[model samples]
Target: MIDVDVLIAGGGIAGLVAAAAFVAEGRSVFLVDAGPGPERAATEDSDLRSTAILEPSIAFLTEIGLWPVFADGATDLATMRLLDAGGRENAVRTSAAFAAVDTGRPRFGVNVLNAPLRARLSAEVAQLPGVRVRFGCAVTGALARSNVNTVALDDGTRVHARLAIAADGRDSRLRKAAGIGVRRWGFGQKALVFAVSHPLPHNNISTEIHRTGGPFTLVPLPDRAGVPHSAVVWMERGPVAGRLHALDDAAFEEELNARSCGVLGPLRLAGKRAVWPIVNQLARRFDGPRLALVAEAAHVMPPIGAQGLNTSLGDLRALTALTRGAADPGAAGILSRYHRTRYAPVAARMAGVDLLNRAALAGPQPLRDLRNAGLRLLDATPLRRVAMQVGLGAPQGTVSGKP
Candidate 1:
């Protein structure tokens, strides 16, 4: 039997962040993951698919001491450009300047590929004396008592810890075993992510363009071999996208160009394409007696605006703070506390994203005009700017430090 202060299930972003946070607080952290395979990698160089770290969220991670390790490996996105298709307006543009003025931050956020970030986190965790990691280990069983959590491994060994956390993906086995259920639905769309080089420089600008089908996100990457490259998330109707993905590179790019409306002045494919069938999901129950869910296990938003992992990190942060560097193993009160901390923000964001998506993709001309006007007014007015800041995860009251 193995024992530790905390037992974390799933070694993805949320689990790693939670493990790292507790270890930094001098808590013995043990992580168990079924293990990651290269087949899941977005590109050959990165084992992680793709994820964006938001500004404030990055600050939180920095406070926990994980940012420096990622500095050299991540890309800083200092500006954002939002385009409204079938409309005529800039609506809003946010820059590091605006963020510094509005929130007193130098940069809003940094974008990093998953593989390197994951690797650095793994390496850093390995160096921490309080952190223990077991890859290639699957949990065959789990039991949470009032004082601790016991997990049975596939190999017949049992491990005990003060708490067991589920951060595995949306369909979390740990969550299932703990009686957690999630509401999941296919968005009838698929997002195809790949790297593309453009003749025009992205200029540190990450962009989101809304269309009838869905949003197309273009995030900047470093200049590669003197070519300006960007990471693209082109979302389209699932049936069409499935057929598009099955085609050869030339055919896929042709279809992608048709979807993008020549935004980047002709996109030249630079990496392997990865496709995700879009879905919106959230857990029915965030926790069981001793088991708690974070990240995709707890809630999953559509990939719009980098909500998936960011919300996951938020859950991790709150869980760490509420747990206060100690675990009663699978304590229900602690689990409830963790769930409560995450419930509001997670549910709010889920509804908000769904609303935005539905509104942005609405077919009715009148509703589109109303949403567009609201979108425009929100950006053009100071009152709306503050509201936008709050919607963007700034502290509830103000961007000032008092909160």
Candidate 2:
């Protein structure tokens, strides 16, 4: 039997970060993934999505010695702009800009591409002492005992650990093996993700345009070959998104430019496009027995306000703090504390994002008008600062483990 202090199932960004974080605290860890390792995964053509690492997450990464890897490629997001273009002509009706200065910060966060960030984190975790990383290997099952969990691998290996973390994904197998249930619902909407280069500079501003189907967002990205570029997450109804994805490059660009309202002036596809179904999910509980769930395995929200991965990092932060000097990281007391600390906040955040997504899906003219009015009210009042703070996952200007 292979023995370790921690066994992490899933080698994605969250799992990698968890491994590094635990190892940094002087714990032995074994990380496993069903897919190819980061080296191969990074070279793939899929997963063109980008993540906005908010301030709190950045601090956590820096503490674990993983921030420098993403520093060079990170693009600052100094401001966030919201536009209501649900008008009949698909033209902008009302707009609001929230500057990071209002929050007493220079920038809300820095954005980085998903693949490269995963690769860099994987490399950093591998170099950390007291850690083992195995790609193309999976945790087939797990059995929890009084003091340790014995995990079964697909290769007929048995590993024992004081704690088992399921960072696998929304459909986590380890979560199921641990008998943890999840609440899930789909938006009947899909998001089209890709990178684009435009004639106008983004100026470090992240913009989200609200119309009939959903919000079309343009997040700042590092320049490519001296050209201004941004990552686009254009959300629409399933059929509409499907047709757009099936369209050829020229047709797609035409439709993209129209949806963008020419705000960036003739956007050109800078990378391959991918489509993702939208959904909001939360695990019924954060932990069971000698196991704990983190990241997508615990909670999942739409790609709005850059909450998905940032929230996952928040899980790592909370878990790290709760288990800092523990002899058994997965002790029932520790897991229970983790569950109590994380569940309510994550549930609340998921609810808020769900409400925003439903509003963005408003179809009728009157409903769209109502949504626009609400945006105007939020922008005009002091609620704007509160909104910005909530969007950053910092309630009342305080960065808590809730993140």
Candidate 3:
């Protein structure tokens, strides 16, 4: 048996981040993924989604030495603008902009395309002496024992480690093998992800427009060839999204522009469109025996507040902190503490996001009116700042730019 401190299954961003964090703590790690390498994954047209990395998560990556490389291709998020168009012919009814300055911070967060971020993390992990990344390899099975957990790989290799963190995404083999059940439900909505170039600058602002269907978000991205650009996540009902996806480039661009409400002037497609169904999931247990679940393996929320990956990063952060200096990485006490600390917050956040999504999709006019009114009220009071702080998942009084 090849012994290690941590054996991570699934090679997504969360998996790679976990490997880097564990190695930074002087633990040997083996990471396996069935997909292509991060660099290759970045160049693929199918993986065009971008992530808005919160300030706290950026700091964590910096501590582990992965942020510098990712920073090169990232764009700052100075403000988050929310527009409600649910009332009256989908026109902008009410708008609120949450600025980092309101909280005495320079910027709220930054947006990075997933492919480049994955590429950088992959590159960094390859050079780390204590971490090994195995591409095109999948975790076929797992067994949790009293002292350690064993992972079976598709390539006929076996790994024995004090703990195995499942970052394998929403459908996790390790979680299933560990008998950790999850609560999952599918939203009839589908998200269309792509990049666009605009004549006007985004000014580092991320915009989310609420309509009868769902949110259409435009997140800032670094200029491409001197033209302003932003990544777009347009969510609609499954049938509508499918019809839109079939439109010609020019037709789709027109629909996209209208949905965007011309916030950044005219828009043109800069990347291929990728679609994914929206889902909500939360594991009943974060850990069992010598095994622990992190990232999507633990929970998955809709793309509403950029909480999906940020929540995953929270999982990594909590797990890394709990395991530090522990004699047995997989001690039941450590796993129990992780479950206690993480499960509630994750569940609460999931519920909150679900509520917001449901409100946005509410068919009743009275309900929609109430939802918009609540948002306006929040914006009018000090609760706006508090809400922004809570949404960012940062502690109160924590400055954004501080390391």
Measured by TM-score, the strongest candidate is 2
Runs of candidate 1 with Cα error greater than 4 angstroms are 37-48, 87-104, 325-330, 364-371, 387-392, 395-403
Q: Give the TM-score of candidate 2.
A: 0.97
| Quality of model 3 by C-alpha lDDT | 0.86
Candidate 1 clashes between residue pairs 3 or more apart in a chain or in different chains? 48-115, 55-108, 147-328, 148-329, 162-329, 163-329, 290-330
Q: Tens-digit lDDT track for model 1 on 180-267?
A: 7778865587878788899998877677776556777888877888998888887777876788789998887776676666667788
Instruction: Give the Å shift of residue 32 in candidate 3.
Output: 0.6
Give the alpha-carbon lDDT of every model: 0.72, 0.91, 0.86
Give model 1's TM-score versus the native structure: 0.88
Native-to-model Cα distance after best TM-score fit, residue 37 in candidate 3, in Å: 1.4
Candidate 3 local lDDT, 219-302, one digit each (tens): 999997899999999988899999999999999998988887787899999978989889898899998888889999999888
Ranking according to TM-score, highest score first: 2, 3, 1
lDDT of candidate 1 vs native? 0.72
Please give the ranking of all candidate structures by lDDT, highest first, separated by commas: 2, 3, 1
